[model samples]
Target: MAVGGGLSCIKYLMFAFNFLFWLAGTGVLAVALWLRFDKRTEGLFQASDAPSTFLTGVYILIVAGALMMVVGFLGCCGAIKESPCLLGLFFIFLLIIFAAEVAAGIWGLSNKDKIVQDVKQFYTQTYNNYLQTKQPALKETLRLIQFGLQCCGTTGTIFDGAADTCPKKEGLDAFITTSCPAAIDEMFDSKMHIIGGVGIGIGVIMIFGMIFSMMLCCAVKKGRNII
Candidate 1:
């Protein structure tokens, strides 16, 4: 397997790339888990009526991140072992993940408005329930939402202000503030380009990975045939 030539160089390069990719996948999985289960946010998701949009996205991250780690491990092992069979499997897994990512991007774009509306509804319900019950959990949830979005109540007016949770703005800014719903929509709109850029970058990386796997697999087979 060690054909000891340029193919060896490709093998090491593949191993290094996949090692870094594995680390990145681990980091992504960690962050997603934290967001989903942190003490402050866990209550929000555990409720019977939790919104599916946000929760669904987190679950997707968890699954994708885990898959990435597995694929990366397989890639690293395949490269080091120069096993054509392992490399073939790695290429298949990578292709599947890439396809899934592309599909997710398209689905997200097509349903952006629906996603925003679903989140807004959840926020509105939480805001109202807090006003009536004044429960600490609800209050903290609202605080997290307001602070995270850097937004205030629905109207941006005194009504539903829930000032304690909203970010502090003084003078003119207090009167003219962004509402949570608007902030949510604006966040999605503003980040569209960034999301797209990231997706394209990942796509290019996957394409290169697939190409490398196939190249290495072919070279390994050729070396075996020669020997």
Candidate 2:
């Protein structure tokens, strides 16, 4: 009965892995759609013509999809080898990651509101602080903001074409003289990297689980004289 139960458990885990594999596939598709449509029309999204929130939502989905894929692979091995020890370990690791992802998702959902408010506040503060006293500088700053916003919503080429917006007047020439590069680095420097790192670490754990389960299966089969 113990052997039969272990085998059943392994079968269920393999199915679970298959489900997660499909889930990750869908996530990648969603990201592709966002890159194609939403990214190029940030201003439209802000005006509610299109859903811009997907940009952030898709990022979360990508991370979750990766985690599911790793966990599913580990589960598959555990089921194939009929090793309760491996499946049990895989479940424990999955639970830890699942908890963390849920927490992060919750925080992200809440933070979306906070981010919009904060950006608005920053813009207001900058206008009040710099608009009057530095009228010449203020115009330059607005130009920088416009360029930055455009580049942020578009391609990296926006930064290269910045000289086209130049030919400044009086003190404004100093503004053109100053360089305001778009924050292209933010894409990779996101906090998502930490989650991805953890997922990779968990993948290593799955590798060990697969090896151990295979050896255990081999040993049991040999001792029982069973194929």
Candidate 3:
């Protein structure tokens, strides 16, 4: 089989893309596992009465990560072997993943306010519980939220009770800083554009994968050397 210059380049690109996809899958899986085992959050998972919002999201990510790995494997093998069957399968899985992503984006957009409110409520509850109990688990959890968000307590004012455990500040910022609730709002408001951009970028890459897979499949079917 004599593969042409153009097709050979595309084949290599396909392999590269699939390799990166595999790495991304690995990263997602690692993050999911971390969240599953992290001491501060693991306690929440152990309790039966614990809220399911964050739990559900972690499970979804684990499944998605695994699925991406499988799809990526198929794509890589198909490209390397020039197998029409494998490439077709890869295309099908990519299409399904793309559809799922689109559906998720739509759902997230439709329930933006609700999701933000729920998260804020969860933070508020955690903060209040910490103020009353002074438990280690709650303190660690509070620290995670504060440091991760770079925000103080729910009130955003220096007078907030949980401010002591929040992210450290210097001078004026030590007293005047954004609140956790405000940070959450920014996540759904101004910061949401960054998330949307990432989504679009991923979607574009997936489109390229699907396109290249089909193209390679056709090029191989026509007896063009792809290897």
**Which of 1 and 2 is ahead in lDDT?**
1
lDDT of 1 at 224: 89
lDDT per residue as tens, model 3, 1-227: 53467998888898998987777667667766766775434644654335566567568768877888888988899899888899899999999988987887787688777767776777788889988988777877778767767888877766855666787788999888898888878745753574456557667888999989888888888874434
TM-scores for the candidates: 0.82, 0.40, 0.72
Among residues 3 or more apart in sequence or in different chains, the pairs in candidate 2 whose N, CA or C atoms overlap within 3 Å are: none
Off by over 4 Å in 1: 23-48, 132-137, 159-161, 190-193
lDDT of each: 0.78, 0.46, 0.76
Give the 10-residue window scoring lowest on summed lDDT in candidate 3: 40-49
The candidate with the higher TM-score, 2 or 3, is 3
158: Cα error in model 3, Å: 4.6
lDDT of 2 by residue, 36-66 (tens): 3443223222432223354465556566556
For candidate 1, the 10 contiguous residues with the lowest summed lDDT are: 39-48
Span of 10 residues, lowest total lDDT, candidate 2: 152-161
Q: Rank the candidates by TM-score, best first.
A: 1, 3, 2
| Candidate 1 lDDT over residue span 1-227, tens digit each | 47578877888878877886677567557756875876534544755567787679768978888888888998999999889999999899888989998898888788878877887888899989989899888888888777777788887764553778887888987766888888877866765565566567667777888888888899999988998
Q: Pick the candidate with the highest lDDT.
A: 1
